[model samples]
Target chain A: MALAKRIIPCLDVDQGRVVKGVNFVGIRDAGDPVEIARRYNDAGADEITFLDITASHEQRDTTYRTVEQIASEVFIPLTVGGGVRAVSDIRTLLNAGADKVSINTAAIFNPELVKEAAERFGSQCIVVAMDVKDLGDGSGRYELFTHGGRKETGLEAVAWARKMAEFGAGEILLTSMDRDGTKDGYDLGITRAISDAVDIPVIASGGVGTLDHLVDGFSEGAADAVLAASIFHFGTYTVGEAKDHLARAGIHVRR
Target chain B: MSKTVAVIDYGMGNLHSVESALRKAGADRVVVTDMPDAILSADRVVFPGVGAIRDCISEFKRLGCDETLRAVIEAGTPVLGICVGMQSLMTRSEENGGVACLDWLQGPVTRFPQDHRDTAGAKLKVPHMGWNRVRQISAHPMWNGIDDNAYFYFVHSFFVPADQCDSVVATFEYGLEGASAVAQGNVFATQFHPEKSHDNGVKLLSNFLDWDGSC
Candidate 1:
């Protein structure tokens, strides 16, 4: 019996190094991806996700060597995202030994990229991440942002998510544009809405401030996993401490 | 004499961290060697490594450690395997054209496809890496002092598909049922690496050291 909920730490990479920012701005050195990855690996973090925010937009490829470098150093699952536009792109990363590949803007433009990857790699290997922004109206309209949340496309977030799952997306990464760097909390409405709409695993991203946010994403939003930055970077909440709290709250989390 | 835990090293695994970890966890005796009498004499045995299952089995044949391990476990000494070492405990593995395994655990071993929708790995990633939590089940001695749903370090693309539900002490959901940890009497194995999992890892091995197999 596999557990349903998980907590993940996201490391945004640019130019083969780890970097983090608020609202995707003011990128700061988070340290070597390998070094930081080892720290999290030692901390008992459930999973590690590396997003190559600079790869595709800069006409580069996934960090094949770096991915392998990290893989060799740490003994845990590694999920890589960004600039994954084609099947061969996925192949390069996986062959380099990444456990999973995540797609964002590419799936938005080509939809079939998700289906093709899922059909070939199997749905579990395919993750479609949606950087979504709430349009601020009772109309409850949401737009999808791509290219590291730089480009915005006019697609209703929920419906597009359904299409992605239908196309064989094993999991969905839902990040909020409005709350990304605010450290306010997750966009619970957005998280809950999409989670309710899809049967596949949903990982909540953006605006995580404290340990409680991790718990809320799993319980209130019903997200299978939650991702955040400042809280983890600033030494606010450790994964062990977070899991302990989640357990106390009665949410199923790995201690 | 202090209880000894033998981690068989056949030049086929990444056992440095595992040995250091077991040592750090207070296992008074941790030896890495292919000497069968020493392995069989120890109170516990360990198999550790990283590579294709086929290559692992081939190395086992070359060193003849396989026969010694089977004898030791059949003699009822507790034995454990880690990662590729863990996968080698299975009946078969589909890696670099597949290979027969130690048959310690039933069924085939391969990557865990994210969604049940894909199994052959044409789209999903093969080598699943990173930390994922385990959902603990049952009253196996492996659960001694460990809390339920503890996070463990996992780095593999292929996994042992679940068929003998009872053998699985725990499982993980990456998109499907990952036989996260399988224990059958004196033989135990897990997909995650406790050696690399820090304090939690140390605690897990400690539990193994202190296990009485009563509950």
Candidate 2:
């Protein structure tokens, strides 16, 4: 049998509570990170990713505590993204029981962090998360964005993924800012582009409105894994249903 | 009777996850320690690692954990190694320009060939991340409750070639067949991370805790 494609439930955690906003607005508390993670684990999620959306520096330790609590009970791989900046930050997160740390803003500002973090922590735990916005410029190009897709970096998404791979990133978390919260679907173009450009696995994120979107990610986007927030969080679809759908679609998934 | 499982900590990578998993699997007490005395005195030993082999081996030597591990194994204590910890049990590794290992497993760890291609002629990714099905090749206590073709979480670039080893208890396919788990006497090791491998992983950890280190 081949490696089964992963279906990861993304929890946008703010101040230790799970939250999901529409287009980065209208944020509402979903539940506690630990409780929500346990539910997802029971639902047979392949992995759990917690994007620490906590903004205050004083309250940042809450995320670590939340991660530690979940890791104690959740047996699946836990990836914490959103504010990973330094190598020490990665260390603290891993020590707190996070299986992997996703770096987005830091990688663009200081590319060396990726190299050094991978060298120190191993590439398996270093995931380079990229927030991309389709230019719609008819040039069929995607640009990288930072600050939760508020600011643009003008760098080509495909080339950046390749560079991150060369710099020792084990995986890429590619998100589409355009389709995010739109219930449209993943921007398969950029997802496939990044997936084809890098030999490392790419986790397609954002705009997963239905279970079929997950299958499209693996088949059309060539993603090794797919990530969604609201669909699974709001009880519209359980992770089990997603896996069954993918399996029926001829995609191998852990059931 | 109460049991203590010591997860060797040499500042290599995260040991808390393994410690928690072991505790959840029924270990009375789990200690994540770099101290040799505590490790040797524990009822069970877990050697887990991440990152490069060069650094893992160096830390093992610096902390004298290697020597301690040898003594623990000689005393017939059940030992479990995960990921790089499994690689370090080999004779040598091609990682970091060829480094000598503990030589307990009798094989060399080699990187997945850069040119290794899938059926589509596309190169398979290194670090073979995510869940892959593991096929049991031989009977072992570790597979007590685990299925024949159970899926396990694997993440690594280097692996022990299955053909070079005779103690292989489980195997998995990436671009090539590789040893997923091996058992010899009191020591059982796996390239996959059981602590991160969901319920099946919990079953394996529970089995290891109950294992008497026999075939």
TM-score of each model, in listed order:
0.62, 0.97
**lDDT tens string, model 1, B49-159?**
665566667878799999998898788887777877778888878876778888887867875544433344312223344456777866687776777777676656688
What is each predicted model's overall lDDT from 0 to 1? 0.74, 0.90
Candidate 1 chain A: worst-modelled 10 consecutive residues by lDDT: A21-30
Q: Model 2: per-residue lDDT, tens digit, B1-215?
A: 78899999998988888988888899999999989899999999999989988999999999999999999999999999999999999899999999999999898899988856777675577779889999999988789878898899999999999998887889998878999998899999999999998888989999988988777
How many residue pairs clash (N, CA or C atoms closer than 3 angstroms) in each of the candidate models, in the order given?
Answer: 28, 0
DockQ of predicted model 2: 0.79
Question: Individual DockQ of the candidates?
Answer: 0.11, 0.79
- Every candidate's fraction of true contacts kept comes to 0.10, 0.80
Q: Which candidate should be chosen as best, given TM-score against the real structure?
A: 2
lDDT of 1 at A51: 86
lDDT of 2 at A111: 97
Q: Per-residue lDDT for A42 in model 2?
A: 82
lDDT (10s digit) by residue, model 1, range A1-255: 224356788888886777763221222434677777777767767778888867444444436667877766665556898888898888777666566789988888899899888766556567899999988787888889875567779898999989998887878889998889888889999999998787677889999888888888977887877886667666777777888888899886655
